[model samples]
Target: MFSTRPRDADAKQFIAEQKTLASIDQQVDAFHAAQPTAPDPVIIEHPIDPVLQTGDSQLLGGAMEIKSPWSEP
Candidate 1:
């Protein structure tokens, strides 16, 4: 015969375990709150142009050479 007594015991055990987990989560939250967080560092970098002119040659010349920054010099 099925009894409500066993179901009640299982419910009580589940509630106890849930409480234990909740206490652990609270402790972790408190520890994190106590620690101070630092701000991210600022990074500075030079912007690379897609096209780099190596020599004194002007675009007005009959023929000009264009080099891509990605190409090896």
Candidate 2:
């Protein structure tokens, strides 16, 4: 046995709160849409790190030589 006036008031209050949350969500989405996104990373053909290379590094002109402690000199 519930009164109709109180039920209507509660429904209206819930709808208003939901609309407020929806408005805040829309604002946040618009803010992110206005910001600029980062650029994609540069692609490399080989595993060489060009940024940290020096003059003594071997270029991609020929095959790289790997020397290990187990290999004879």
Candidate 3:
């Protein structure tokens, strides 16, 4: 059979320990709250030129004529 009488010393110690943990949690929360949050990244996208977008045969022929820098003739 379980004892009906309360363990006062154990209960008091448990409560004190819980209070200490709660105080630590509060301090951690306050420390985080005081810190400044980082700003969102700024994305700058430049518009593509219409001339570069076109697939021209002359451009491809000119590009093909250029020898590879790694290869010797």
Task: Provide the TM-score for each candidate, comma-separated.
Answer: 0.46, 0.51, 0.58
Reference-based lDDT, each prediction: 0.65, 0.70, 0.67
Inter-residue clash pairs, candidate 2: none
Question: How well does candidate 2 score on lDDT at residue 59?
Answer: 62
Compared with the true structure, what per-residue lDDT tens digits does model 3 show for residues 1-73? Answer: 7787689977999999999999999999999999987555544444444555566643443221222234345
lDDT over C-alpha atoms for residue 64 of model 3: 19
Candidate 3 structure lDDT: 0.67
Best by lDDT: 2
Off by over 4 Å in 2: 1-5, 46-73
| Residue-by-residue lDDT tens digits, candidate 2, 1-73 | 6675777888899999999999999999999999987555543344566666645674653334443334345
C-alpha-based local distance difference test score of model 1: 0.65
RMSD of 1: 12.6
Ranking by lDDT: 2, 3, 1
Candidate 3 residue spans exceeding 4 A from truth? 1-6, 54-73
